[model samples]
Target: MRARGLALKPYWSALQSSIVSGDDRMLFPPFGNFLVLPSVSPLYVPEDAKPSQEDLQAARGVIMSEAQAFAAEIRSAFVANLVEAHNGARTLDSPLEDVDKLMRLVTSAVPCPSGAYCSTSATFPAILDHFKVCSSAALTASSVSTSPMRVLAIQRVLAAVNEVEPGKVDAAKTLTAELYALGNEAFHCEACLPQQAAVGPAAWSNAHSTKMGWTKMVHHLLVRHTMLGQTLPTVIYTPLKPPSDSGDAAATAETASGGFVVEDAES
Candidate 1:
């Protein structure tokens, strides 16, 4: 969780910038100033018409809400994976059933080994015998040292009980359910500027607009976010054609001959 927080630092910073400046360019650079329109031509906002304070505040609030919801969804998935991994390690056998069998095995008559218990060499029967003998003596004689074989057997049984206990599963289920509920709340929300903010007064009054403007804006922002997060691929630098001039050709050729420029992968 700490590592996840660290990884999201840049995203948080960008979100904060968007909220503070009332400009989503920090979050969605490419389509921040553009809006979705129904016509073939794109809608552009004029510089003179700034977004209203109400629109700006609403846009920031919506973006923040969507971001938080997205984070919650991711957190829920992470918790679900954790629960699955923990449950996968457990055996299907009931802990109570195992404990009953273990108790009976420890009490039953069995041949005790002469030498000290060696975990690597000792079989299940040998361990039971050692535990039975050591436990019986320890009950009467307080001075008798606890046997490693007895401790090992008890630990194994308790570990099985701890891992497969019904309470833990119930608790995990409750937690997962809560996370899923949170995830559902953000299903329809998206991290993008609202239509009223993205499209200023000029474009907002245009008749070519449709109700799908917000959906398109969200999609555009999503594409920009994905592109910005990706590592830039290495490509050969191709120089553009030089202007047709006798004297400038030599200078342009020399300038264009410069070696490949490596682009930074970080956005």
Candidate 2:
């Protein structure tokens, strides 16, 4: 029903504000280098739901583990930025993972407003809304930058990360299914439930891990592509490494050319 099939209500407030202002905020949300709180809310598990203590513990474990994974994403990005600064650029053997990490990092940091649908389900509308929020955030972030080029570059990077190209998104869709399915089976549904519709704590943990894994992979791929698109031109307007010596080298050059300057006795 929502435009583009994205139940966009979750971001209504934020998006409305962005549209009104033409989105002048920084927009990229600090490059998501560090994981923070999750923007997406966890599955709707009632505090009073009569699940066993073990199940509750399991759910809490999943949440905590995800938080940690999100944190790791930020840490990874910080390291990558450091290495990039020194070594110039290094592509990961697996970029999809990187994309997932970035998403986790970003989502964790900029907690989405409470109204947003917080599940991982491939609710096409919901997923679209997620991208809309991310994009708006990125644009808002970029607008304040004095450097327009940097802003545009960042926008492209964020866009690429959120893009969800056709055909490639099926895996993401599946991940959404697993997350929602797991949530339903473990915490939500009490009706039409299989007598044996139960998962061991170990098994549930594994599913969570797998979900996070694919999520990270996809997140990283977008990041890599975004990174690639943002590849700035090299040695163009920017000068190459300045001459090794720029001190009074002009004087030294003149001395060698005209033989007037005296060499240091120490030399």
Lowest-sum lDDT 10-residue window in model 1: 32-41
- After TM-score superposition, the amount by which residue 157's alpha carbon in candidate 1 deviates from its true location, in angstroms, is 24
Cα lDDT of all candidates, in order?
A: 0.27, 0.28
Consecutive 10-residue window with the lowest summed lDDT within model 2: 233-242
Question: In candidate 2, which residue ranges exceed 4 Å CA deviation?
Answer: 1-58, 89-267
| Candidate 1 backbone collisions, by pair | none
Look at candidate 2 and tell me the lDDT of residue 22: 23
TM-score of each predicted structure versus truth: 0.19, 0.19
- Per-residue CA lDDT of model 2 for 160-179, tens digit only, reads 32342223222223333222
Model 2 vs. true fold: TM: 0.19
Q: State the local distance difference test value for candidate 1.
A: 0.27
For residue 151, give model 1's deviation from the true position in Å. Answer: 25
